[model samples]
Target chain A: MEIIKIGMADLGVAKPPSRLRTTGLGSCVGVVLYDEVHKVAGMAHVMLPESTLAKNGEPTVGKYADTAIPYLIQQMQKEGASIRHMVAKLAGGAQMFAFLGTNDMMRIGPRNVEACKLALKGAQIKIVAEDTGGNCGRTIELDSTNGVLQIRTVNQGVKEV
Target chain B: MANFTKFGDFQFDVLREIGNIGAGHAATALSKLMQKEIDMKVPQVRIIPFDEVADCVGGAENVVVTVFLRVEGDSPGNMFFILDMDSATHLLHQVTGISKTVQEWEEMEVSALHEIGNILTGSYLSSLADFTQLNLQPSVPGLAVDMAGAILSYGLYALGQTGDFALTIDTAFFEGNDQVKGNFFLIPDPDSLPILFRSLGVPFDGDY
Candidate 1:
């Protein structure tokens, strides 16, 4: 009945009548997993590629692609969504600054996308749609009722996948 | 990760003073460029969660103009000069006399803004180096007109690795009747915190 908002390095799951949303994704991937049969959806705003890259203490499970995808799957399954019935849609992971090429961090956007794809493949979840890898920021929302992902950008307007 | 959460009032005050010196030099440079007087607000030093970082600049999706620089050398961090649409328009008009509505940035406007950012951030860094007596270097400025969330997050990768929270020293300044307003943000990497404090002769709680 309400929208569940996810912040940076966070994830959430919802059932019918509830939607999942994350805004202002730049060089960060927004991964959505949905089960149309169960009307369930889960989303994560992933900031980095791997959890192993963390130099300090343990990071949150939702912050890295290696951990977030599996965690999202497990959360959705608790809501009656099965991995077999679930499909994935992705948005975000855009390089906001083009001239920051010297730093290895500049490759983070594409690396995030690559890592997400690898994680989804490991789970055998087919990516039904994607809007990724550009020089812009995106806000994405997933509708649990019909398994649609809507992406919005500053210059490109809005599109539903 | 840094135990910045354990910081005391004195630590925050020291950070505030750091922002003050850096932004003060930048403001003086800006005043000279425009030949007008400018006033700066007191700097604010905050340690906030990532989700709330964008709220400091309007919001995540708010359209903004930003000039970004990567500070390297003894103290590594990210530097951002953010301006709203009105401020960007006002700036372009003052510097170049191109008074067109700033819906989309032309090549010339982008170049002018980039140069301004280079000059201001250059001065900002040089003055900080003078104060702390540390060797600080800034990368070439990169200009972008985009959503604030997207632009600002680009500066977060280093800090995001260690923890969910970010420490930023921010200063806002006004130009001539407060029509043109901009903010200067210095987000030092987690590893650089101790180096910064040691240079300023402030005691960092090593146990924390």
Candidate 2:
């Protein structure tokens, strides 16, 4: 089976006999959207909560939760996946460090999770499973064939949802 | 994204020098702490894509022990002291005589590693502050043993909102002929670049 790799602040979609994978997500979040009927899966490794938070010229669509989710959906739609049949699985918004309270960016892990959930809700997509908000980093993969989302961490081994 | 493409060789040299000054002091402290000579390498300053940042130490999935601290004054940024699994074990063995593997580490081990990071990073920043005449302070150091990508990316989010690329100053450490190896990474926020340049008497705005 082919595994499509998504880099940080990046996204990709895969068809049957393929998997979408992203690794070592700490403060970032990994979001998966699957259309079970069509066997299409999309994954995004988003680095921040909102595109509006960008301080320079706009970053790529996959860099933030608000922008990445919609962009991933649009890409999946173009791949013959229907929005009505889509469901989401989420992982990897971890507070890797203790709360310092001085910089708001230090709390980015939880904010990324909340932002992804809000974006999914705005798109009217149902979230089937999520493994988020912890002090550990995670690597995640989504299989297009069975819509199984697998998450791996340093201490906790692989778990599927 | 802040434009790293426009950076010139002179600007990069400045950054490399900054890394040298900081890590030089840090290495001296480490050498004294371990009572073993620590070898230093010429610093590498680069503007790397977010995905490739973790590749500096190893792959994204590679497990590492990291000491993270936030720099909160003058030129605010992030600092990380990273060690691979084997190096972490060896460091513990050499420093505290704890010959246990990373899996066998307990609270005392964790606290020991955290203090080492704090002392080393504190030395790195104080030396830099003295040289630049800039008020730079580090938050209490935090320690985590996990995937390199996960740990490194925590430092990237502040820059993530501003750009697709991170400008990093990296200094490699090898203790007594590579017995223990580690990496010192200093990633400054984009906004701080100008402040850093100005503090050093380097012109912030000019064509190169």
Candidate 3:
């Protein structure tokens, strides 16, 4: 099976027998959508919540949940997968530091989780499983063949969703 | 987000000098604490993508012990002191008489490492502030033993709003025989670049 690596603020789509993976998700969230019928999957390593937060002239779509989710859905459709049939599995929105206080940016992990949920809701996509929040960093892999998301953490070995 | 590409060679050299003074002070502080000679590599100033930021110390999945602090005041930004697990343990053993044989880090061991990071990073920033005459204050240091990517990403939030690229001033230090090694990464907020340069009487071209 081919393992496609997705970097931070990046996204990709793959078919059956190919897996999508992202490493070291701290405050960032990893959103994965899979269609068992077509064996198609798309993964995005979202660094922030909204594109409106961007101060750059041109912001990359895969960098934020607001842009990444819709873009990933479109890419999946291009791969012959129906949006309605795609199920989402989320992982890796974590507060890596615990004593950073209540600053909005300090709470980025939870905010990222909320943003991804709102975006997924707008697309009418249902989230089947998630492993998010807390103060640990996670590395996740989504297998297109079985629509399973494997979550790995430093202290907590590995679990499947 | 702040484009180091726009910074001319002279500007980069200035920044490198800034890192040098800061890390040099920090290395001295470490040596004083351990009573052992510590050497620091010349600081590097570069603009890098978020994906490659963790590669300086190791890979993204490489587990490390990091102390993170939010830099506030004239040149607001983020600062981090990162050490590999082995080095963290060694420093702890040398400083606190803690046993390094244990695989898992106990509470006291973690606390000892946190204090070391706090002192080292504090001296680094304080020396920079003194040199630049910029009112730079560091928030309470938060310690974490986790993947390098996860630990380092916390420093990127300020830059995330501007772009995927981050301008970093990195300094690496090691003890004799390579018993302990750690990295210092300082990422100033985009707007703070001009303020920092102005404080140093250096003219910065931001209209690229």
Between prediction 1 and prediction 3, the one with superior DockQ is 1
Query: Where is the poorest 10-residue window by lDDT in model 1 chain B?
Result: B96-105
- Going through the candidates in order, the fraction of native interface contacts each one reproduces equals 0.85, 0.95, 0.80
The DockQ of predicted model 1 stands at 0.83
Cα RMSD over interface residues, candidate 3: 1.2
- For model 1, give the interface RMSD: 1.1
- Residue B159 accuracy (lDDT) in model 1: 86
List, residue by residue over A1-161, the lDDT tens digit for candidate 3.
89999999999999988999999999999999998888889999999999999886878899899999999999999999998788998998899888874888889999999999999999999999999998999999999899999999999989999
Per-residue lDDT value at B181 in model 2: 94
Q: Which stretches of candidate 3 lie over 4 Å from their true place?
A: none
lDDT of 1 by residue, A91-150 (tens): 988888877765688779999999999999999999999999889899998888998899
Candidate 2's C-alpha runs over 4 A off are B206-208
Total backbone clashes of candidate 2, pairs 3 or more residues apart or in separate chains? 1
**TM-scores of the candidates in the order shown:** 0.97, 0.97, 0.98
lDDT of 3 at B103: 59
lDDT of 1 by residue, B1-208 (tens): 5576668899889899999999999999988877778899999898898888889999999999899999999989999999998998888888788886567678888888889989999999999999999999998888878889888998889988888889999999999698789999999988888889999899886522
Q: Write the per-residue lDDT of candidate 2 for residues A54-148, one digit (tens) a residue.
A: 77676679999999999999999999999999999999888888755456878888889999999999999999999998899999989899999
Per-residue lDDT tens digits for candidate 3, residues B73-135, read 888999999988888888888888887643577777778888899999999999999998988
